[model samples]
Target: MADNATLKAQYLTQVEADLERNTKEKDRIATDLAALQEQLAVLEEDHALLVGVRQTLVGQAEAAAVTPAEVPVAAPAEAPVETPAEAPAAVVPRARKPRTAARKPKAAAPKKAKAAKAGVAEGGSAATAPTLVELVTAHLTGGAEPRSAAEIGTTLTQAHPDRKIQTTVVRNTLEALVAKGQALRSRQGRSVYYSAPEKVTASA
Candidate 1:
């Protein structure tokens, strides 16, 4: 009878120990599950934010594509109102005075152009100084390689020593020459370059 009681007590103690261990293991698993749930919520919030941004960008792109179609639709409505107003001004004799006055200087323009061309060809004599446009073209065509406007401006600054020249002015002059087909516009990487049309053709 005593052996039976001792065996029952030992079995109860072992069962209690197993129950305690199981409770601890359950607590640990619950804590890990809670942490995983929190991480999943964070990832979901991030996904929602990215989806919102993508939707906003798509909305903007759609709006941009629609806006250009509205321009041609509006242009014809606006053109009739503008044309009559422009027509009278275009034909008025009073407007001709200013235009005739402008043409007077234009007549002398060819003479200056001839002199400038001669100056550029003859290496720019003191008797006939080259214009800013001529000077820019000369500098661009001076080298076998193409030159940037900044470099040309610096060279002009060094050669003249009298006048202050801006790189912007040189750049504008170079563009004007390009528009007139006297100079070639080219790009090397990010920097714009200029050369004489003939040299550009030869290189090509």
Candidate 2:
């Protein structure tokens, strides 16, 4: 009877140890399953993101294929019309209307008087003003010594302050006079001088 009890006690202790081991194994297995489930969830999210990107790209490509290409059409050219030539028509003279007797001659007379006064003023100024060529010629003749274009321009500007005389214009006029044999052009060193032919002959 004591042997039976000892054996039974040994069996019971072994069963308790086995039950504790089984419980620990079950807990370890549950932890591994939870980690595996989390990995699966991450993989599923990545797969959805990739699928969405691919679908967006495919939709853009489909939209591009559905859109029509724009092409410019040129307008047609117009045809010119030819017309037949006709003979010239005769011109008829219109009848003249007589002037009214009640028309004021005094109003017309004042306008004609103003026009005449303006004409006289313009003619008097035009007659009194000497030409540029005439002035240049008179200056050259009046000067005794041969003068450079600069000296001539200065003298003319001082004498005729109203006239806008340029040195280039004076030089051009001197060159023209030289071409026409009306004036003599002499060069001393690098400076050029001009004088009337009469003055040159008198100085000579």
Candidate 3:
């Protein structure tokens, strides 16, 4: 009977110890599970935030694609309208009927004054100015001997300082007079000399 009691006490003590160890292990696993759950909640919050940002960016891009940019359209150019050829005659008679007869005498007065001024100016200049051809002929006639083109040109240029007489023009006029038989041209060697027809006859 005493051996049976001792064995029963030993088994009861061992069962209590095992029960305490199982309770401590259960508490430790609960703490570990709580930490893991907290970490998972943080990850889920970060995922939700990233997904919201992505959706907002995608929405903006879709909106931009749907809406087009505005462009200004140009106005069309208008073509010019042409009047008929007979339209001027119809318009002129209506516009100028009252003023036509009244304005004619007034317009004619200024035209007559202009014509008088022009006539006086022309007549005065014509009476005073001797022609270049007449001057050249008179110079050749007055000269005693046959003159070279250069000598005649120099004398005429000196006598009339106001005149712009070129030697080439003088030579051309002498040739024309020679052709018309009004002046005589003689050549001594390569030098050409000119005189009036009467002078040439006297010299001969």
Clashing pairs in 1: none
User: Compared with the true structure, what per-residue lDDT tens digits does model 1 show for residues 125-176?
Assistant: 6648767877887777777878887889999999998878988667766766
TM-score to native of every candidate shown: 0.37, 0.43, 0.46
Candidate 3 regions exceeding 4 Å error are 1-103, 201-204
Q: Specify the poorest-scoring 10-residue window by lDDT in model 2.
A: 78-87
List ranges where model 2 is wrong by over 4 Å.
1-117, 201-204
TM-score of 2: 0.43
lDDT of each: 0.73, 0.70, 0.73
Model 2 over residues 1-204: C-alpha lDDT tens digits?
999999999999999999999999999999999999977876775455346445545655787876643212111211111111111111223333212221334445677689779989998999898866688899988997899889999998999999999886677666666756888877564466889887874433
Candidate with best TM-score: 3
Ranked by TM-score, the better of candidates 1 and 3 is 3
* Clashing pairs for predicted structure model 2, backbone only: none
Clashes of each: 0, 0, 0
Quickly count the clashes in candidate 2: 0
